[model samples]
Target chain A: MIDLSTFLKEMISLPGLSGYESPVREPIARTWQPLVDELSVSKLGSLHGLRRANVKGDHHSVLIATHMDAIGLMVAGLDDGLLRVMSIGGLDLRILVGQMVTVHGKRELPGILQMIPDRLQDKSKAGSPPGITDLFIDTGLPINEVSDLVKLGDLVSFATPPQEMSGGALAGHSLDNRASVAALTLCLEEIRKFNLAWDVWAVATTQEEETLVGARTSAYEIKPDIAVVVDVTFAKGPGVTDYHTFAAGKGPTIGVGSNMHPALGKYFKTLADEMDLPYAMEYMPKSSGTDAMAIQVSEEGIPCAVLGIPLRYMHTPLEMVVLKDIQRTGRLLARFITQLETDTMEKIFGERKA
Target chain B: MKELIQKLCEISGPSGYENNIREAIKKEVTPYADSIEVDPLGNLMVRKGKKTEGGLRILISAHMDEIGVIVTHVEKTGFVRFGNLGAAFPWYLPASRVLFLNGTRGVINSEPREDNTKVSTIDQSYIDVGASSPEDCPVKIGDVGVFERPFMDMGTRVASKAMDNRSSCAVLIETLRQLKKSPHELVFLFSVQEEVGIRGAVTASYAIDPDLGIAVDVTSVGDTPSAKQMEVGLGKGAAIKIRDSGMLCDPRVVRWMRETAEKASIPHQMEILRQGSTDAYVIQTSRSGVPTGAISIPCRYVHSPSEVVDVKDLESSVQLLLKLIGGPVQLK
Candidate 1:
């Protein structure tokens, strides 16, 4: 049995916000290095780990991607020792306020996320809402020293550490995806013990929050015959009515829609149902908003699918994820990749049997 | 070269639905091809060499599709309500021209009665198919529509609709024409439905069982005014893919293309597209393993009513591909 929470805690301790993801990059890459065959970085900063299956003619290449990058802020301009910032990826302003952050300056400095009071919020003046200009981070440093140390484009990340809750749940800063990365790490570890066919490339994709660029470049590096993107999706809660049928504490979610290949979607759903693992379905009409969108269209186009862990308060400092979901998802991917051979895999999109 | 480019541009092959364009491309390449076949999904694969030899099996794919719209609903007042087949900026929709797959023409008109703010919101726009009633509408749901042809010469830049990828299709065509006897087992797969999801390449690459695949397509150029400060430039030459939002070209293959271009003195640049993906990504990872790369013809205003490209760049891409095909297939 894998101690998933322990690994999640270590991952959450690292502040890897989007473009400034150096802190978590090398550590996570090193974690999975012994389990994988070849580990390298693409032209982009995506960390790719390859594990070749022992079977001969198991020449199939499969990529399982989970972006290591997370949403946070970049120091655009310093104002009076306070950091004026830009959101590197999608930052829900509603959740960002009153959160703790770490300002990555010449050195890592602790900071608090704050905004002007509601009087300045101007609720009536709607449409596009307030820009990042309205929000500022206070690091408690002198203006002269702050300006000298922190220049524009300094990365800022949430300062939250991963913690286990009573009901098999974990809360952290980047549970939106780092939890998925942890799951991929578990998959890497488990596959090492088994003698499987096919080459599995476990990728900790970068820049997925900013853009799906990391998966794009990394997919090219792995050049897998089949690709699977693991990420997180919306978990329903109060005030979040416009969402999918996914719930927190569920095992995992399999994407099914136009963007998702029907065969791959059905295949995952069937496996989840047969294995008796709790799973839900989500519609990915155009783009899954995961690395799947990037991986699905790699050279000659990789037949792609997505496996997501339901997450609540996504893109927030206190992003929440369930523990069992990670373990189950990783197991499912390990089994799927191990079972893959050229013959059985070619039936990926072929007609179903009676 | 000019005639080939003109013919490729004139043909329409919208994403997810490409039949006529594949037929047209098949007729053109059939003479030089050893065996020609179109898959069930409509991907046209033209093979020129034998599978007997242990020579490299390479798939040179060019998407025969362009971005367009599908008629989702037809209003009672003879207007067609539609949605985009791929990513489309509404700024390019209103007052622009479109053509249906069945040769029926339509004009995209903004809802004049509504506020200008909602013009691009899909509901505030409809296609005018020159019909007075819903019964008179020639098109129906599932029918694909693409931008109407608009070819022009603006100084050195040639402007046209669907140049987003048709320019590269022309490049692929010219490159094949230049190679009378390919040195390797070549699969010239004129892929269908690329503007949508690169649907054609997915099927074609599987059938060819290619050891290496190269997607010839269009990339973004920064030479345009206020463009995203891209290192790639128009007329500078063809672009060897290093990294893009799709797939990264095999480093050894990229080095080979660059070396081939530089040694032959064919002007070429390396592209680093951040937000967009290409067919190379799908081809690169197909089946078990196949080394894949892309050579893109840089174009301006991708997926818009009017796209622009430099003919000099198109010729350079063709020339570089010619060098690759004419010589031995080498993989590092």
Candidate 2:
């Protein structure tokens, strides 16, 4: 069995930015290899780990999706020697000024994000954060040497290593869905203690942050009767305290939104309540911004429910999550999967007898 | 007030993504407000003061939303092409840091041009988080990013991004914290989506349907070098709105504000803003037409990343509100 903290740290260290999830996918596939019966990779680079059901009748599969991509930057051009970059996900420019990054050029090069000095910039804009143009990657190597190593369209990722904070909190980049990925792994491990009836397709989806391509396509191919999307949500911390963000370490968030089926969400909420696990229902008025959005609309439509692990400083290099929440989320999901009956599909989306 | 403003300014709540800001305001005002409720569109409407029978009902509004950028496309090379969510100036965006609600941080930069011509539009610019390829980028198309500058206490003045309305929210929060009693029913509205199209204020004002509406928002000043010739100036007290680019202030509402400021001896200046409007404009047109006016905070660099506001002006705006609504609305 893999240690949760060690697994999460290794996941964060991998460079699996959207569309480019191969680097991270390799380890995920390896981790899922022993637990799943059949393993396959999607055309768009999504990883599929299938746990077959033991039932004698027709098989019903449940797709569990957690996006594996991390937000990062791409080299747009090289000016003099420094790389001109662009955002791959939602980048907070304020945190970019002094952030350390790794430029994946011909070879991995260590660099510091160099913001144009306040003295050289206009007074009106001085001390004000500069745009990406006014910023460049300083590799410390000579200009010609830097030019030789870096190329246009190279990838740059936050190089901040994972930190184990006080309490049971873990902080690092790519925790958004990677933490959820860890949760899915724990769910698979939990299922080993029970004989489940429904097939479980643990999918490490691609491009959820950039596009729902991985979820949309994977769901269509697998055609699961139900889908449970696990992802990280905002945790109450400095500067973020609203209904949209839940408290970290308290519990996971069950999503209620356009993408979530009412019955499906209610079941998860009831399950959490039944087990005395801490959970909150996040209201998504429109798009849930998860793989469930894609899975819900796939083909004839599948009932989807989103489960979120509370994360602090999401998307930044220092995104933090409580290991307890990940374990709790995994336990709840495992219990829910084991409780699924043959008529569970009818319970989720069948017509009522009025 | 400074601490409150700083706290509010740091929260990232772009249009359609105001839950974080809404939560901050809700927590602060929960103890003082009579009842607090969030509308379907994510508007935090707080009812305060005393409920008087047939007495005046005044609504004080401040938008909680800020200008942002929505990722439109992510290039194969991992550069994210984006569209402006509100009125984020292209020139100001270059070298500015933007953050997604999830904390994905990236800097906005224009694509290099061989001709050395600066990229003037949003399309020519992209967000850089240093991903090497499309697969390497963590951002997806349609993810929203807002300015992520920190609050700075510049002695007498404070500077920060999203202060355009977060500062106003601080004013409303402070007003709620200070006001002990009121003769009229006061509905303090912390609205959303103001930066995009004043969407939240419109829906919120329609629901309240108050007799009078007053919006507290930051207004631009011509205080900088060779700036446009505008009457509003930073540190010159609150700018009492006469009219702006959005709506003409109700003459009666304007008169009411002016006399109240004078009687209370609150420092204020008459403002004839030639551009931009506030939540007041939308509220003024809600229901059977509300007599709406705005108390403008004279701010330099209205929508830029580093918005400057005089702390004195923030205090005066709070005093003026406390004087006007701490008692009955006497608009005769």
TM-scores for all candidates?
0.59, 0.53
Tell me the lDDT of model 1 at B13: 75
Name the runs in model 2 displaced over 4 angstroms. Answer: A352-354, B1-332
lDDT of 2 at B306: 95
User: Cα deviation of A153 in candidate 2 (Å)?
Assistant: 1.5
- Fraction of true inter-chain Cα contacts (below 8 Å) kept per model? 0.00, 0.00
Q: What TM-score does chain B get in every candidate?
A: 0.94, 0.97
How much lDDT does candidate 1 score?
Answer: 0.78
Residue A38 in model 2: lDDT? 93
Best-fitting candidate, measured by TM-score?
A: 1
| TM-score attained by model 1 | 0.59
Over the stretch B1-332, how does candidate 2's per-residue lDDT look in tens digits? 89999999998888999989899999999999889999999999999866686468899999998889898998888888899988998779889998886678898888677765565578889899788788878888889878888889999899999888899999999999999788888999999898888899889987897888999999988678986645567888988886665654665677788889998889998675656778987786564356678999999887899999999999999999998887766654
